[model samples]
Target: MVSKQAGVDYTETFSPVVKMTTIRTLISIVVKQGWKIYQLDVNNAFLHGDLHEEVYMDAPQGLAVASSRLVCKLKKSLYGLKQASRQWYDKLTEALHSRGFEHSVEDYSLFYKKSANSSVYVAVYVDDIVLTGTNLVEINNLKSFLHDTFKIKDLGQLHYFLGFELLYREDGVLISQRKFTTELLKEFECLSYTAVTAPLECNLKLQAAEGPLTDPTHYRKLVGKLNFLTHTRMDIAYSVQHLSQFMQDPREPHLKATIHVLRYLKNDPILGIFISNVPDFNLRAYCDSDWAACPDTRKSVSGYIVMLGDSPISWKSKKQATVSLSSAEAEYRSIRMVVGELIWLRRILIEFNVPCDTLTHVYCDSQAAVHIARNPVFHERTKHIEVDCHFVRNSLQDGSITLPCFHY
Candidate 1:
């Protein structure tokens, strides 16, 4: 679809989207509380948005118009207009606000209405809405209101939205992208390829100049698809992150490694994260780093996973911006990364009116790093990472996070 001219035909195309982590967290909450979760679709959602800026379009064929050169002025948003999404979001937000739903400061797409007896959470991603709450009557009222306002279509119990396919079992909710994965493999002719045990090879060192150059566009598309799969499949997170570095000028070795990742996906495309229905809601975090893992840049790779009860809601595998002098420093930097995530997650939980413990436990295997966080006496060795030390230490002092030494 061709988009309208920016700044001329329209302005302000930005629209907030609900974070995948928030979606998973909500699912976990639903599973634990036995709350009813439903999906809503706004029919021709963009068309419901009222246009503030004057937009004109040529009349379509078969339209009875006085003159052929005469153009039609648009009173509402259209499919190809640049400002369509923002307009629709503004309209929806107004509707929800009028109904006493407050916007979440942490995630703009999340709107919640809380009362003494009932609470309703509505998350919006464009036209798709995921609604979960304790009150079924209120939910039905909401459905009727949306239907009257924007012709909302009730999709019933949330089985699929976006690319994720959710399975609501007795134990918990299972999320995966089996359909998307199958289509991706079929598109690339990798559906029949032999499955592999792992996403990447052990001790596989890929260089920017290694092997002959391949089609950079094809390599980028493969990497991009794999990166999306990482949302549900954390097993391929590090591999996809590693492959993304070669997007500018991918080489033959890079393509082969990417194919290896695809083969790994072939092994079990249905495998995904299962948010269990555990009673506990306390948050926990684990972080680790591989010192000088990148041969090309000598930069450390930081990996961390944040869990709510037994369900993993957020995780990331990223290369550090700068090289660390020591392994402890790398580990400390990783701790800092996770501490930030922990703080944000706690804020989100607070918005949900969920009680989080005073101090969320953060585990690290490196005793040196743990000592650095607690003692603050290793000035000579910790000066380079003083910023990270200060951030983590401040969180510790304020009782936001605790760095516990754990080996496993």
Candidate 2:
């Protein structure tokens, strides 16, 4: 248990996270090489680091300091300290670098060593580490090294991490978070609640202004937990994004909507994204938008989903920052945003030795948006749009993306 702080103990406590693209890329490489991925846990990970900051703590009830007025000075980082994560990261990097492992330029948390015949890669997400390599000997050697320095547990083969349940198959690794969903349901006391097929009703619209919440703290906590669950549940992405807008002044209706989501999860607890064994390396994306979807601000809702071959890897649903004049403009903006994600995914794939073509396919449901992307002639209709919105046109001209008119 953390002691109560008299004042603000931390100014900014955000930790750097490895992007989903990096994780997917690493998994894809592991699949291609038919390599085994192992999981390791650094016991009391934060305590293993030496603290640089002068942090003090009050003594526990039973334990007393020998010095009458002396306080406990921290020699190592504690869980709630502001600089704990950063200090741990710095220490781990120095140790890994000294052992001849080089970090990836695109992803700092990824360190690797490669030779003409063999390669080994390690991806660190806080304390949990996923080790992948070409040979089992090298993997075991590295595991022994980490164990000697820190208290490490070798979880035979990678089965779970960060709420993801991994199933290793002869074809490829299947990733899901069904176990995590079950735990979430039991925690919220919604394990036996009636479920709904869809996360939200087709016509149901959420707004910022709603009724008063009975308990704002409880509502906010539910929203935060659901947000983390989105790591493997893409179906809840839109619903969670809509519900998150009410954190400031959540009303009873808002809480009900959030609870409705929980009920839906109770029914289809096993549903999640499935990564398959398809060998196709083609990059494809779909972008869609609902014009003036938010009733409060009249702003549009833009969403996109990107896939590599047969697996859906990335998706997002967000409220547009600006009010779009028409559905075509909103769709165009959505397509532009998805293209950026696709390009980055392509780069990360290339880093993993996956072969990708020069141009990626981006599908849009709006014909007008397709016309805008394919045509260079900008008329008065599109002149009001910011210049950055024309990135789709630039991508088309440079043969980086193929914007095709598609239905749904």
Best by TM-score: 1
TM agreement with the true structure for every prediction: 0.95, 0.91
Weakest 10 consecutive residues of candidate 1 by summed lDDT: 1-10
The superposed Cα distance between candidate 1 and the true structure at residue 379, in angstroms, equals 1.9
Residue lDDT tens for model 1, 1-408: 324677877778998989998998888888877888999999999988889987888887788999877888888788888888999999999999999999999999999999998899999999999999988888899999999999999999999988999998888889999999999999999988999999999989898888776467888888998888888998888899889988888899999999999899999989999999877789999899999988999999999999889998899999999999999999989999999988889999987778876689999999988888898675778876656546898899889998776978
Q: Which ten residues in a row have the lowest lDDT in candidate 2?
A: 1-10
How much lDDT does candidate 1 score?
Answer: 0.89
lDDT of candidate 2 over 1-408, digit per residue (tens):
345443454343444557765776677666655777888998888777776555777776788569756678778878877667877777777778877788877677888887777778888888888898886787788888898888798997888888888877777777777887888888888877888887887788876666766779999998999998887788899899999988888888888888889988887777777666767677888889989988998888889988777777788999899999999999888988898787778776765667786578898889998898888787977988888888878888888789765764
Candidate 2 structure, TM-score to reference = 0.91
Screening candidate 2 with a backbone cut-off below 3 angstroms (N, C-alpha, C), the clashing residue pairs are 211-251
